[model samples]
Target: MGRYKSFLRQRYRAILGYTGLICLISGLVIISPLLALLAYPEELPLAWGFLVPGAILGLVGLGLWQLLAPKKATSLTLQEGSVIVVLAWLVAILVGTVPFMTIQGLNFTQAMFESTSGWTTTGLSVVDVTKASRLILLYRSIIELFGGAGLAIITLSAIAGPVGSGLTSAEGRSEQLAPNVRRSAKLVLAIYTGYNIVGTIALKLAGMGWFDAVNHAFAALSTGGFSTHPESIGYWDNAVLEIVTIVLMFAGGLNFVTAYLLLKGNFKSVVRNGEIRFQALMVPLCSLVILFGVAIGLYPQLGKAIRVSIFETVTCFSTTGFATVGYTEWSSIGWLMLILMMLVGGGAGSTSGGIKQLRVYILYRSLRWEIRRMLMPTRSVTEPSIWQGERRHFLQDDQIRQIGIFVFLYLILFCIGSAIVAAHGYSLQESLFEYASTMGTVGVSVGVTSADAAPTLLWTQILGMFLGRLEFFTVFVGLVRLLRDTRPILT
Candidate 1:
């Protein structure tokens, strides 16, 4: 066991060591958004205080990285590779919490929850937007930006992987977007930033103030739902702003690989990707259902109805929890549909969360195959399919088992979290919604998950935040590693 620990340490030191360095990078990024706002007339005591201390930590991290990190580079193995991904994400979220604590006046717990929620593209928050500092508001969006682009993917992409090594994901966080991970990261980051700037400027032109516009721009591009005001997009109360958010939110939910391909004039990539088609087709479909509900029952004004419907539709499909208005007030069918959409989420390789369209497509294909196999096992060699090209491939039996296991785990975790909330004296409906918000990373709740709640219950929220950000697997593995590390080696 000691031999294995030494082997693990030396074999993947580069990937292993960079976790701290990336946290420093993330810390600096967290502080970067605040510099401009510090120039504002408002005496942002919390913002400046948070910035100085966090910046120092980042510098300390950078200095330590320079001194203690590997002099020579090495690629991580599959096991080490998975560990690196887990550790890097954990550290990124840790550094991301600084602004929430120092600037936003959230204690470590709420700060961690909000930061984890943002970076996971899960829109949960405990901060009251009406009273937040402008700089802290931007910090929320920046976290979404980091989460939207996959900080781990960005880091992986920035560094050169070893010879003959490739980053591959058969399921969660799958395949590289470019020939090399670093180059792919560069391409995605460029596109991500471009979209954010465009979204911000368009909102500004549509009459939004600089602070709110830029913040929403970050949120929309990351598909994160944090806003400068509690009512979210509703706070703007502008038709043009809603239109801009709808467009940008959808853009953020798309696969960056296809985004890059479209930019390069390879329109075929969009045509060929199954999940992209599902997203394109489903967005309008969900909108129509929401439109029908809002137009016929929810509202009397046609324009307002359509606008709200579009906003909510885009929000749910993008896995963003921002509400132009209260969705819980809608019809039962409408509420259920939105809930279903929240669980399904947007495209893969995009900022959105939930089960994702790609998995849904695969699950559907596998289900159809199962029926066909049962009906004509002796005659039919292969099942009929509709998704484009290679993506049309159905889940194999092993893959199906894996998916089943993950789904079970996801549901169980949600149930346990909900139970914990209920034990804390929240009502059943609120408990369920809180758990769903955490697991979905959607951040919408019945006002149950908050800081004023009991401190004894902090661990429940923490679990939700960790699992929400890592999307279950990493948090589980990291916990296991923690336990394993503490136990003496049996040998």
Candidate 2:
């Protein structure tokens, strides 16, 4: 047994060592919900809910780390990094469900769904928060806060080496805010912490109680839409709260690099950023279109219409999933507009999930260049460039092709997910809406997801949320690596 354990460690240091450390970290996260009970002691039994799994996970993590910790820190291959990310999420979802199972009569499927939703920052839930304990509610919010921080960034500060950078990149973050991996990780953590503090305070001043404010701030900045009330943000009916959440959600959905630049007063870079410019244009334009639809049919009053429009549009664009008004009552046009927003998603390298605005900008620019090429003579040349932080670099053909493929795969997955849901007897539009919500990681369900939902549909939604959050490739590559890794054992 000892010889085999040693052999495994020697062969796969990155996988076993890093995954063990991550499990340890997740165990700590699982226990942190106890602080919520300390802050608001609503249900005493809920402490046991988290404690049992937390302790078991901690022991397992300790055992794995002891057996597998590498003698020295080393870089991880892209495949290794991908495996670590995927493995960490699988364990996270498992441990995250402990409290849910303890809290109610939820089966493993329902608990897994809620846990995946929270950790992925997808915000879809089968449990009702109104009936849930404060500790459970706080635990859900805490999941978003850390989940938004990205497991790589959180664990990177402690794990020194190029492995951190590889893990960050695997999770879709490309920018480095500081010199070393640890410093970069810490800097991003600081930025996220600052945002959490400021957002919580702002929400509190906007009329939410301290607990609700903290939870909503965590959810909004994480783009996780778990709400204390069933109506989401609409329950408050406070314009101030809505506006505060809008700002936080937008900020949350922004690229960390852009946010860092803006914080440093680099306004010019933000202005030149292609993703920012695209979001600035697309958000308001889509809102106006939805507004027009709502004005004619849903809300006749101008003020009411405008508020709902901006709230829903920002929520959808940011992939935050909060609802000020149910789109079920909206016209088909309204639903289509929001669905398009969900498909476009928010900035890459941010907590928001979907096909991403960066790819959309690239694909759109590529489209125009294609048309120009078709119209011009064969000998003519057109420079296709996009604005980055400080410079304008011409877009490469490979880059364009990759972006196109990503968008194509994303739409394909959406259709596949929709088909799975539609097989359960839903209409085309309903399936599209539900799958779009899952694929975008945007939790605004059109009546498909629920506690009573079929196990197949529930699991499909779970798979969709996981794939969407990781943007597909990481998980796929991880699976391939897993098969390869296990071949020796199987043989």
Candidate 3:
């Protein structure tokens, strides 16, 4: 009984320590939206929208900090780490909705949907962008910036020691940018910030105004897909701007390690990357499938068809959520190809979300190797291997099994979400498309999701976005931990 009490005390202290740190970080981040009001002095009175909430969070965080100060070296268990991450995200979404809630005609539910969508980088919007204020637009863009950098990477860097590696992994990252967690965090921030700067300048040169350029840069590079305009990329109709966006989105979808390599001037390593090669092969191939279908009857103009085909293919493949045209207007064959691209999303370790290209490559290679083994003589021995960057790794049964399970769960969630949407009186095709977009974290809408969407469907998509962004395992583990810890209360 004494030992059990000690265990509970330790766990409670850990929660307070970690959760307090997260609140402090979130409190500081919450104040960033107020900068938008500053940028537009005419909206000065709107400052209280962020200021009130930011002050409350900041005070709460400071109180926790003083109340549960750490004593000595502390270690976080796997369960604690996962739960902390889950809690942090939930808090961020809840706090992020404050500004949206302050706006008229938007309620708590709509505010939460938008907040989750932005922080998850899902890019879906419940409110119309054209009708939103400049401060609101900037706040929306800034949240995507936060999501792209990842709150875990930012906050964990300050306090994560030997035990903190698991914290980063909980956020779905495997690579350590540096041996020291802090240095690794700084390196990642530098690269992410650099891309935003370059992408913004490139877009401005391509004929976008300063305000639009900054927001679009944040969205495209994060694969967040939030647009300042109602028509999205189609709003400008500038081929140069579209091309520039395509390039930035493609870059964003590539693994961050690939970006690090380029920054380090290792071109050869990038060229040999398995995910890079697979992406190169799939983009044009998928576009051709779309082009062929659209060219036959849907779009008679060759130029228009080719342009739309490439844009949508890249958009879906990258999971960037930007649409040049309404995909529902395309043929069934085109929709299939686009949906397939969403399933086989961008590379692992990228801002883009989905099953990820690495897993797809592994599955494909494993199947081919299996075929060869079946045709070989009974005694013949064969081993399957994959090339990632310059390293070669022989396929292990365990690794393949894990990949298979992740992909399976992802699809299972997609199907379940789609069924729920269909229950609300939408067609299967429409339900599947929107749910796939939600579960894949790809933000394309088929008009089913809106301010008027059923609350059930809204909550369903929220679950999909949260699960999809965390990639299932973290949330699953977190839930298991929560139940296990609550046994005393249940009794």
Candidate 4:
């Protein structure tokens, strides 16, 4: 009982500290956006509201700080670590919503959905952002910025260290780059921030206005894809801007760890990386196929078609839904490819979301291995494989099963979401696209999602954003762990 009390106390204190820090940071984010809003017409005083909330939150955090402070844990369990992760994000979403709610007069539910979408880097927007105040616009970008930085991750780095030797072991990350998670978190954050800065500059130089540059940078680096203009990057009509976004989004979709390694001049390591190789092979091949489909079938002009093809491919792979053209209007084959891209997603540990290329690579590789084993049972003791090198670790039955389970659950959720939207009398295509957008956390749509959308469908979009952002499993495991913790233990 005493030990349990200690663990509870320690975790409670950590949550408070992290929450406070996020609130403090969120306050600063609110201010920046407010300053930006001053340049706009509304002249809404959104910053004042954030002031009170920020102050109250900081004080509460300060109070929480002194009460449940920690020295060390007797031990850390997977349950405890995961509990921390889940609670951390929940608090982040709640706190992050304040700016949105205060500015938009949104109900609690709508506010939460908007905030979660931004913080998750899902890029879905509920309110009409074009006429909205600068503060709100800036607030949206800040949400993407911090979210891409990983709210829990940033907070955790400030409040705790490696969590202990066991924390790293449980999380399935190697300490190959850093001695502790604090270092790793900082490294990733630095790279994330740097990427945004560089992307912003690149976009500005590519003829985007400073305002568009910053917001797009926030979206791109986060792989969130929220745009200041309604038409997104397409609003610019500049090929140079597309090139800039493609580079940033592609880089953003890659594993941050590998990006870190590359930063340290570990070029050879990235070259040999399993995920990198698969992503490298997939992008160009997908682009070529998409280009072929567009040129021969979809468009009358070749140059125009190729531009559309490359843009869609980049948008799909980067999981950045900044569209230059509506592929949804193209042939059935083209839309099908976009659908596949949303499902496949970007790389693991990237700002982007999806099943992640690594899992897909692993699943198919394992499939090939099993097939080869069956065909040559008498010829060898082992199975033939589709992948070699670092990803060999993914060949295990458990890994394959895990990947299959996630992919299946993701699809199931997508279907459930579609059905929910369909229940609202939306067309099948609209329903499916809504589901895809929600699951991929990609914001593109066939125009079904809106304030006018049936409330039931709205609710589905809300939950879809939640499921998509957490990508299902985190919520699943967290809920199961909570259930187990609350249940009576049998002797």
lDDT tens digits by residue: candidate 2, 1-491 = 56665655565765777788878888888888787666567666668888889888877877777677776676766777788899988999988888889876589999999999999999888987778878888888888878888987887887755444677777878777776877888888888999999999999999999989999999999999999898999998888889999999999999888888999999998999999999889888988898887644578778888989899999999999999877677788888888888888888889999899988898888888889999999999896788876668699998888788888899998999999999999989889988888989888988788999999999999999999998788998888988876755444
Quality of model 1 by C-alpha lDDT: 0.70
Would you estimate the TM-scores of all the predictions?
0.88, 0.95, 0.94, 0.88
Model 1 CA deviation exceeding 4 Å by range: 1-5, 38-48, 160-172, 377-379, 383-394, 423-428, 456-458, 481-491
- Winning model by lDDT: 2
lDDT of each: 0.70, 0.86, 0.82, 0.70
Clashing pairs in 3: none
Worst 10 residues of 1 by lDDT: 162-171
Q: Which digits, one per residue and each the tens of the lDDT, describe model 3 over residues 1-491?
A: 66776676667566666677777777776677667655578878777887787778877877776677465436666667677788878888898899899863578888899999998988988988878887788778777887877877776666635445666777887676677766777777788899999999999999999889999999988888999987899888788888999999998798887888888888988887778889889998988888887744677777777878888888889888998888667778887887888878887877888899999999998999999999999999888887765467799999899999999989888899989999999998888888888877888888988999888889999999998888788888977887777775334
| lDDT score at residue 412, model 3, on the 0-100 scale | 88
Higher-TM-score candidate among 1 and 2?
2
> In model 4, where do residues sit more than 4 Å from their true spots?
1-32, 35-44, 72-76, 165-176, 295-299, 383-394, 483-491
TM-score of candidate 1 on Cα atoms, chains taken together: 0.88
Off by over 4 Å in 2: 1-11, 161-164, 380-383, 489-491
lDDT per residue as tens, model 1, 1-491: 67887655554445545555666767777677757655674645555665775687677667756665576545544444455557667676776776677667788877777777777777777888778766777777877877777756655555544321322231145544666656666777889889988888999999888877888888888888888887888876788878888888888877776677778886765686778777777878888888886545878888888888778878878877777887556676676667677777777777777767777876777787888789885876874444432245444677777767776787787788889899988866667666776667676666776768776565577666566555666546555654564344333
Clashing pairs in 1: 122-441, 157-181, 157-182
